[model samples]
Target: MSARLTQRQRALQKFIEILVNLKGQMCGLGIPLVAAFENIGKENTGGVWSDIFMQCSSIMKERNINAGEAWKKALENNKNIYLDECDYEQLWDFGERLGKSDRLNQEKVLELEKEKLTIMEKKAREVAETRGKLYRSLGALTGAAVVILLI
Candidate 1:
């Protein structure tokens, strides 16, 4: 479970990186935000992250709402099984600032979120490694004890 959590955190970090790059593209290349999100959804298929981006893009295009609101709605519509409440809260905070400011400010928000996720991912990786080893050792000991008792 810890390993899965680490993977999810890593995925989220990558997603934020993509968002930062896409934001840059939107500013530099004059690409539409909806198209950027669509591209991200296309690039990252077969994941909850992709679904969120696609949903956000659809909402933005259909309802003509701000990106923050679209992101919040997308998050609400798609629940990521791997993430916890704290992770969801962080994501919600990030979504609150999405497209609510200038390009630099948006980039700053993404970078800060990325930094936080990086730290969290590292900590989760350590816990997964340590706890995995401990669980394996405990399992082996339990099996040995059971065998001894039976013999």
Candidate 2:
């Protein structure tokens, strides 16, 4: 498993991935969201997100990087194209909140899956134990018969 990321980075990554998928779908129809995010990237306010967005793009360019990079690229490309800083912040913030909630929901699902696995494992163990006792009893009976024949 990959190491965990900070809440902000995680949120940013989620937003990026969502937008990328949406953009990809739109691209098939020639209506990509790139222009809208680019406008957001162009804005200089809303903390250091502009720099973060650029970095995200660079990171995404690498073969091993994940959704975070794509998000960065989306923001970078959006600058001077679609959104201002305030707009970018609003979108980014919204995405961040959504990401966190999504993550939490997924975690709950995984936990339930694990619980099911544990239940299955316990059932398997019970079956094996029962089989083991039956085998042991059969072995003892066979040994007793062999001794009687020898006598």
Candidate 3:
């Protein structure tokens, strides 16, 4: 479970990085949000990150909603089974603030979320490394003891 959680955190970190890049392309390169999402989606391709962005783009194009609402809607529609409540909370916060202000502010929000996810990923990795080994060792010992008793 810890390993799976670590993977999810890493995926989220990559997702945030993509969002940062998407923001840069929109702000610095003057690309439209829908086009930017389509471009980024093509570049990243395959994975929940791409799917979420593509969905957001689709929602924005079809419904004429703002980026934040589209983002929140995409996240809600595609539930990540691996992520826990805390992870969802952070993601929800990010979705709430996305595209609500200037480019700099949006970048700041992405950066902060990235930092928080980094810390969480590190902690989850540590737990997986330590506790995973312990669990395996305990299971082996228990098996050996049972065999000895049976013999």
Candidate 4:
């Protein structure tokens, strides 16, 4: 790794850090989704989560994470996961969905979580490698400049 980071690398590292924190907040605390969202602001470590929170619209503003007017707009803008796309509301129709058990719902949620993390990890690693190369080039340039100055 280089001694310094370019703007893009810094941004990617920050993103990965926040994503990992969000994952920990969900899995480590075992908090409900809504509860976790609400609690993100109070937690000092969830800056990325907090940024997403503000983007998602607060409950005070009558915005929902999944199915709502705000959600539709977010989807229109090509934003990430929303309830409208996931048909999360339909999951509540347990009568038709399954035989009176949340097992399927839990499995679906787990699968989604795993997918989310896997994608994030892949992106993070890619950015990290790219940034490492940029940093090496920059470090060599700086070293050459110093040698010329000293000579």
Candidate 5:
């Protein structure tokens, strides 16, 4: 509704666009930045989508802008024209967590694989023992038949 709100809206919109571009510009830079951006709206910016919305709302209550109409108009005509600094620390923290989780998962998988191999080896040994018993039984039966025939 008001010119100030309109300008702020454009600024915030441009900031979001810049953030999106910056996220893809680097391989390791994007994910943490995007996550931090999400937190910005929730944690820093009064849980609103942008500061422009909050500004326009305050203006509307005081008859500065036309009660949410300007907010809608700003959305239509907004352009992002700036790049803001990202929260590097949070990104690093998230990446660290991801790295640790990946390592733990790989270790667990290897442990399971080793256990599976051991079980397979034990099963093979059991099968070999059974086969040996069967062969001995057959040999003894054959010897008994020969002895009986001779007697």
Candidate 6:
């Protein structure tokens, strides 16, 4: 139980570090969104996401990770790719967003994404610092209680 508590909190810490590095590269090197995504995904995930586009295609039919897949499709086709577009929102599949008229510029989307992620990073930092300790304590206390009850 304590391990679970620690694992979850550690994942959040990793998220913060990864997001910062991602934003750093974007601001520092000015790489394209697709290249950035590919590079970050591969580098951060340790090759689990080496070909995120291909992985996104495999996950397309599933409901999860739709926005991510949409991002991949936009890049693969060299079209503007907003994180979310209403016209493409209800399309129900990754393929539908292709060649759409309503897509936003990738650079603009990247800027917005970074801004949003900056705010998210701040919030994540708070949670990682405070809530993690609270949760870990609770987990340990709960385990102790269980042991007491068993004894």
Backbone clash count, each prediction separately: 0, 8, 0, 1, 2, 0
Candidate 6 lDDT score at position 108: 44
lDDT tens digits by residue: candidate 1, 81-129: 4666777787788777776677677667767877887786776667668
Q: What is the C-alpha RMSD of each candidate to the true structure, in Å?
A: 3.0, 20.2, 3.0, 9.2, 28.1, 9.4
Candidate 4: worst 10 consecutive residues by lDDT?
91-100
lDDT of 5 by residue, 1-151 (tens): 1233333334444444433432333223433323433333343433233554444344345554442354444333333412112222222222332212343453443344335434544544454466656767888898999999999
Please write out the lDDT profile of model 3 over residues 1-151, one tens digit for every residue. Answer: 5456556756665775776686678667867677777777777443667887788889999999987788778878878646767877777777777666776776677678778877877766676688777877888899999999999
Clashing pairs in 4: 66-83
Candidate 6, residues 1-151, lDDT tens digits: the string is 3344444334434434554554555555765434555566657352222344334444443434444555545345532322223323322232333223222433344345445545644555565667777888998899999999999
Candidate 2 residue-wise lDDT, 1-151, digit = tens = 0111122333344444444433333333433223333333465542345544444445444544444346544565556432335445545433332222344453443344335434544544454466656767888899999999999
Each prediction's TM-score against the native?
A: 0.76, 0.28, 0.76, 0.43, 0.24, 0.43
Pairwise lDDT winner, candidates 2 and 3: 3
Candidate ordering by lDDT (highest first) = 1, 3, 6, 4, 2, 5
RMSD of 5: 28.1
Q: List the residue pairs that clash in candidate 5.
A: 1-70, 14-80
Q: 2 or 3: which has the higher TM-score?
A: 3
What lDDT score belongs to each candidate, Candidate 1 first? 0.74, 0.44, 0.74, 0.45, 0.39, 0.46
Q: What are the runs in model 4 whose C-alpha is more than 4 Å off?
A: 1-34, 54-107, 142-151
Name the weakest run of 10 consecutive residues (lDDT summed) in model 2: 1-10
